[model samples]
Target: MLGTAGKGVGGAVVWFTGLSGAGKSTLAEALLPRLKAAGKKVELLDGDIVRTHLSKGLGYSREDRDLNVARIAFVSHLLARNGVFVLVAAISPFREARDRARATIGDFVEVHVAPPLDECIKRDVKGLYERALAGQIPQFTGVNDPYEEPLAAEVTLDTSALTVAQATSRILIKLRELGYLEESELARAEAPGNAASAP
Candidate 1:
């Protein structure tokens, strides 16, 4: 169990890591408002948005990727320690950075959003996969680049098989199971109009 007594209140980092089109942002966006409604101070650090700001000018090299993940982890660690539910949606392809993040932020819940690579390709609205496959984008994750899946994630959701609502519900259940949320709040969190309005 993670310590919440001395830290003020519920402050845990719910990290969503996976391939680019694996629905990490979708789930994080779905969960954010519900967490706010539940009276938790929450912040979402999206990979694309962060890349434009925090990781500007960083290339696609392994060192750059690791540095990007490190910056996100550092921010997450600060937010989490200060009693904020930080939702990070990043590819974060390396396990080393994630392990360091878990160590840094003691109360960390890693949610690995893993779907089949083919499924991700099919769902690529941005045509990132197509471009990467065509060699237009170098070192893109899951194509020329690598995505190291989590060996033991607290929650692993296969977006290919599960509906958005179902996947979000499973994450909420995990949060409750880990004692980040109250048992009485599960139904409310999982309720249909709360966070997951999309099918």
Candidate 2:
């Protein structure tokens, strides 16, 4: 369990890593609101948002992707250290980079969002898989670039079988098991005058 000085509240960095259409972003977005409603300070750092901000000029090369992941990891670490939960949904394909991120962020929890490739292609919200298939996008992870999965991730969710709510529940259960939230917290949240009372 992690500890914070004075407040006794610790922050966790939940990294949702997988292929492009693996539902990482969707799960992260869904989980963020639930976490916030539970009185937890949470931030969602989606890959597309980070790519637009920190990695504006970077291309799809392996080196650039590594750098982009590193940058996001650094920011996530900083926020987590300040007692804010950080949710990173990114296709961090390299094992080394993800390992380095775990080392940098002490309370990092790697959640592998592994959906079947065919299922991902079938639910191509951004048409990335189609573009990759058409040779428009080169060296795509899960196509050309390798996605070295974590050997010992804290949580693994197969979105092909799990709905968004189910996946979010799994993550929340893990967070509770890790002592990130007390069992009584949610009950207190429902009580009147509590900070997390529903609107």
Candidate 3:
């Protein structure tokens, strides 16, 4: 279990939940280099990548989805226990499943990448929304299935309204508030010209 304080910043799992096109992956991708540049050991367990490896056999049924999430949570727990920050960007539509993950992780930060269903559909990066609506896909979350919004997430990002940089800025603020990022490191990540960082 990852304690509040440890030999280092103590590890954490920052879990991002949202609809398909909710910018969860985009935000996670944007923040990863920032975290790494701050000299932190961080890993991103992206949903699509998880599906390819950890959840290859899992189907779209609620039971299967929960299992998939549980697998990711378990991996995150193990990694976090070893002092590795795990950033998970999964749809993770069920509240119960997400709560279970929170209970299992030592230090968990929940960030909801919120964009309305219509807004998500409008983005449609993979044409998933169009396909799902056309009945090409079954058991799609937020289409025929449900998305249980988080009531107590540490932070909520309106992905539709804010630029990725702005949303990432808010996330850095929250991590600083939770003691994950030192003030100086947070300030550097917050700065605009820091992408010149080598690592």
Best by TM-score: 1
Ranking by TM-score: 1, 3, 2
Measured by TM-score, how close is model 1 to the native structure?
Answer: 0.92
Candidate 2 Cα errors over 4 Å, as ranges: 1-8, 186-199
Report the candidate with higher TM-score, 1 versus 3: 1
**Residue-wise C-alpha lDDT for candidate 3, range 23-113, written one tens digit per residue:** 8988888888788777778899999999999889889888999999999999998888777888999999999999999888858899999
lDDT for 174 (candidate 3): 92
lDDT value for model 3: 0.85
- Superposed by TM-score, candidate 2 places the C-alpha of residue 136 at a distance from the truth, in angstroms, of 2.2
- Candidate 1 residue-wise lDDT at 194: 88
Give all candidates' CA lDDT scores: 0.86, 0.81, 0.85
Clashing residue pairs for model 2? none
* Ten contiguous residues with the weakest lDDT in model 3: 1-10
